[model samples]
Target: MIKERLISLDVFRGVTILFMIIVNNPGSWSFIYPPLKHADWNGCTPADLVFPFFIFIMGTAIPFAMPAKTFDNAAFNKIIVRSLRIFCLGLFLNFFSKIELFSLEGIPLLFGRLAITFGVSYALMGNFSLKVKTYLALSIFGILLFLAFSGIEEYREVRIPGVLQRIGIVYFFVSLLYLKTTQKTQLLTASVLLLVYWGIMALVPVPGIGTANFEINTNLAAWLDNELLPGHLWVYTKTWDPEGILSTIPAIASGISGLLIGQLLNRSLPQLEIIKKMVIGGLTITVLGIVWSTIFPINKSLWTSSYVLYTSGLAILCLTVLYYVIDVANYKRWSTLFLIWGVNPMIVFFFSGIIPKVLRMIEFKNPEITAKTINLQDYFYSSCIAPFFNNPMSASLVFAILNVILWSFILWLFYKNKLIFKV
Candidate 1:
């Protein structure tokens, strides 16, 4: 059996996963400082880099995790299984936000909505049910109808696309590209795609409008996202989407860059040499990113060219540091916590969404207060935990630290049992 272990990569992935949990599960979303906050519109933030870095790490691991040689039927099958499993897990996460599987209100409303919409649309069109074909048509029509008729209300918020959905779509396309093109060709393709996106965003004037200023409302990216993926699917801004279709172009490039790095690492270069190369490459890309920001600002929402380079460079630099300390120096002691996190990232992310919602649903009444009820999550954070901390920030940090510990223990159990839940 080929021993499938890249200590450095594992450490890098684990670190990124840990940060993702912290930034995502803040004790109070409202109380986060500027670094934790997502970019308002076109600028980059630390939080904004987290998701892309994770995706980049995913790409980096493909070489090790995937079959070593030819893309045979078995290899293809593995990819299909892994991709579908992750995609379903993401959809399930979304489902958890909607309904408790056993509760009265926990009906699979998303599926029900699709079923009803497709059934009606097909019945009206007098077409035989064609499974996914019918559902796809109906889903598109339903989204368009919602955009046209539904006002900007809470009900319509359900229609928007999301980060996981974007990841699914981008993964699908990038995998196809990987299969069709050579490694060098894929790199070229990524470069061209980024350049093309930059050109379109900068030069192509919106129809019936002429202005150089690319403000949130007036920019072509926002207009296209609104026109194509309208309604509540817009992320940060109602008029714009952070994971819009156009922005995904550079996001794929980010993944491709990771794949290239993966290819380099696969070549059996010296560990120290690899670290040196990574440092040099990362610093060069970072400098280019800074220079590019002069013209096209490093905007995370847009997934701007500069932002992609900057984040990719930083991600590589981080991986290099992890590589040096963990693999080269043989420092295995400190990596245990991150190893637990890396081994079960998907499970942790899924449960993070589920646990908070389940806790919030269960209410506890205080004896001293006149029937004052607190959400279970709040009770855990504010009552038992907050007293130990001096201030709100400290309390928040404690909550996040506890969350990490709780989830890390759960992951440790799986790791101890040698249970690797792929996809």
Candidate 2:
């Protein structure tokens, strides 16, 4: 078994997480830099690369992660459970905001069950004893359940298709492919999926609309999402979801791209040859993606076939450079920061999101403005940051930078103490 960890991969992962945090937590979304914002339609940007990059990295890690190639009942159960947990985590995020913290009007008895339950569960993700973790989680869960039954609240429709949910679905499918198939088979599967997706989008007629088209709302993927998920699509675009059902097929291919890379990385080949092959393959795939984009435009929202290939190729190229610099050439000095983030990504991601929501929850009346209150983020940005910068975009960027720095400091403490959150 190849048990040795790759420093470069960790650094790459850490870099992705760092950028993800920065882009996601901008002080003002309205004032974000072009590179930090997602493409509105059929194009790729630096911001667009983050999710697929992580997905590819995750796929590349799968071969090294699996305990056995042969599928046992235990292994199958473990995989399913892990995928479900990830999905649940995403679902939990959907519910996090809707859970009223201090609201007495609705579900007063069940005051912030999701937050309380999650806080207790998150605490258990540490290096605690199994018994302790289980007992505490169960205790919190029981309390939450009791409170939930005490008061019935109006239900809010949840956004099901999200980054984490897509990741979980991709992981499940790709992990199975990795475990069961040869490298050639995996590659074939990915190619077929991309081709199949392209075909479906190009040819298959949508249900309500007769012709198939890749419009923002009327596309086959979007239509299917609206049909199957209905009220569970993304909140931003109720008509369509970026991580919709049909799009997940190509997303699986993105993961498979990583799995193939994982297989290659694990092989007992010369380091120089590995790097050379990666560069060549990455560039070749990238060109193919670009060529194909002329026919089927590269859209991140649809998780288009071209977009998958484009992002996966870039991910490969990025990893190749990282591997050579950090691993082959033994220049790893600067990677320490990313390594801290890579190891405990889940903790940072979950809490980073929660922290912003927590800030919103902890809002107070603005003394300067009568009959108006402000959130922690808004107040901090306006009072401290916005006043300093002439450009609102600069201030927004600064706020995002500050967020990244805060996480770095927090993660450094975890790294120093060796307190890893396994989930």
Candidate 3:
């Protein structure tokens, strides 16, 4: 198979992951720039674009990663394992949260118990059967369940869905579709799925909530989240999940869009033709999304159909620009910074999340503050960084930039060592 692997893919992925880290690790959520914040309920923001863009990029990589059109038992196992690993990583991230961390008096618990249980179980079950290993895994997760809803009311239930989880799921289904179907089939599937999602969300009346609506918690997606899995919901709003079930239907379409584009490049047409087609195609989808948004609305939280189209169109345009400049025009020096992150995105993403949570876990009593306590990360930000700026937003942004710099240094070291690992 002829594969058209462009360096711009890495640069684009790197750029997305960079913004993801910045937007997610703000020193204070209150001090975030408006562009960094997600849309309150409807509309898209710069922050909102990161996830779908990442998903889109992942779809583009699918053809390059797995060129074979055939699927076997081995393929099934590989997809399942990778998807689960990414999903579990997301769960690990969710398990370590600030609001849910504190148990009684600013003491973080839960994850430690789960980790120890897994370690001890694995150590003892060295010669166990597959069935026995399954049992052992269940026991470890059982501990997590017990700990999640065990104590204080302030500590919310553990979240089941997240950015990475959604990514994993999208990867799994999109990969399957890519292997099983032709380009025409994949495109048709994406279009049909989007239309079906639009219909379900618009026409069908939400049960228990009465009329069909897009209200925060009363929407059909929110109802399914609350009904299907009650306690295992996002902490932000217990009633609805941003990466909820129904929204994933449209989310799949976003990934398929990338899959189609990836195949488009595989044809290896002339450079001008590729650029011309991409611009026209991107604009067409974008205009459709805008027109559709008049009725259905382009909601980031809901992961609306229009959202899938809008984001996917922009992603195509963004990749086209990068492809032309970096690949066609031979501009390479400027994108070296992005390549560091692009080379080790999975590790960077995992550790970037882990570092913040680990820092939050290590708390020290504030010498000056009387009534409350602060985590190590927050304390450092407040005392060292926040002191310099009058605007809290600037201070928070600096802290975020520091996170980027710290990770960049780490990624640079990993790149220097060539220690890249994939799940």
Candidate 4:
């Protein structure tokens, strides 16, 4: 008999993806309430929990997705190729989102000098030598350097550290960690990583800055992110990029914890028993997370140890619930929406990123604000959609619901055609 796929995992992944899309695509960012509001600097919010929950789900699915037995060279090569493809796709998305290709005004002097130099050396250099490769490379590098030194200019904000990039890196490293390390070793390694990260953030004094506190000026995390990354690359704030190198360590731990759960679930246990264990485990972890938060502060920007535990615990609890509902109870109807979302997460995420830009390109005049125009997305949400609803929260929900329906339809089409695009 053909074995059945894990209904719980699919449902869990689907639910997580749905929340991710909803939380990300709010009706109006400016009008969001406290729950939706990202943790200001060093506190946990519902919004802060969403990304880690998704990452945790990714970890939970790993054991089921990856082969049980050891792999040969060919299998290893396939894994590497897949990982690289995912990573590169994320980078491509990043590149496309930013607009630093070329500026006619910024390079007038360089263009003039280049034209003169090329004119003088036309015969010696020929058409082949006159290729734009050198200019293009120099231009790209120059733009990056200029951006780095410019100190977070509004128009040049690239938001370098992003969800996709982090997901790519975390997925790649965590998978390797799983392959290389023993279960005990992986758990130990995760523990050491969390403690070490905490120590470094707490103790390390940044140059011209104090310890890594929540304060923007004094925090070492901000200092390191700003000093290390190009200034213009910061998405949320120019002073500190959220996806800094240091913060990623804890993020990986979140995934590792998920891997542990995956390992647990992979064992030949009864469905109801597993659900019970998961709920108990999740609750235990969550309690510990809350307790730890007293000391570590549960900061999402920092990706604090407490935050990781808390989010992971919540993720487990969520999985447990879904497992009970979908797998044990055999309730599959509601899950169809989430299944669609889980199946096409990367595509949906990429489209969400690009679609807003496309909408912004098609702007409508704002009669209330002189010389200011609102994008189609904003107009749709604020003018037409939001006004239909009585409250801001309701309107936001409506907007997110609409996106879910739209994306769900798209994914259903993909599913109908048996189109599963990995990586």
In terms of lDDT, which candidate is strongest?
2
Please, what is the TM-score per model?
Answer: 0.81, 0.91, 0.88, 0.82
Pairs with steric clashes in candidate 4:
none
* RMSD (Å) of each candidate, 1 decimal: 6.9, 3.6, 4.3, 8.6
Candidates, ranked, lDDT: 2, 3, 4, 1
In model 2, which runs have C-alpha deviations exceeding 4 angstroms?
Answer: 1-3, 100-120, 123-153
Best by TM-score: 2
For residues 1-423, what per-residue lDDT tens digits would candidate 2 score against the true structure? 364678888899999999999889888999999999999999998999999999999998887778457787766765665565555566566667656555453334234654464674465454555455445544543443344344436323566677877887898888888777788899999999999999999999988888989888988999989887776678888888988899999999999988888888888899999899999989988888999999899999989899998999999999999999999999999889999999988788677766787676667778679699887778888899999999999999999999999899999999999978764
TM-score order, best first, reads 2, 3, 4, 1
Estimate, for each residue in 110-210, the C-alpha lDDT of model 1 and write its tens digit: 34544443343333233233444334434544544454356534345443445655666566556656655689898898889888988998998875567
Report the Cα lDDT for candidate 3. 0.81
- In angstroms, the error of model 1 at 121 is 30
Considering only N, C-alpha and C atoms within 3 Å, which residue pairs clash in candidate 2?
none
lDDT of 4 by residue, 2-104 (tens): 1236777776777777777777788877667677678877777788877898789787767677755356675555455445444444443454434343453
Candidate models: Cα lDDT each: 0.69, 0.82, 0.81, 0.70
Relative to the true structure, candidate 2 reaches a TM of 0.91
Q: TM-score of model 4 relative to the true fold? A: 0.82
* Candidate 3 residue-wise lDDT, 1-423, digit = tens: 467466899899999999998999888998999999989888999999999999999999998888766799767766765675566566656765533433533432536634542454233234454445445444544555566567645334677788878988999999999988888899999999999988888878998778888778888989998987687788777888999889999999999999988887776689879888889989999889998999989998888889999999999999999989998899889998898888778777666877776677667667787667678898999899999999999999999999899889989998899877565
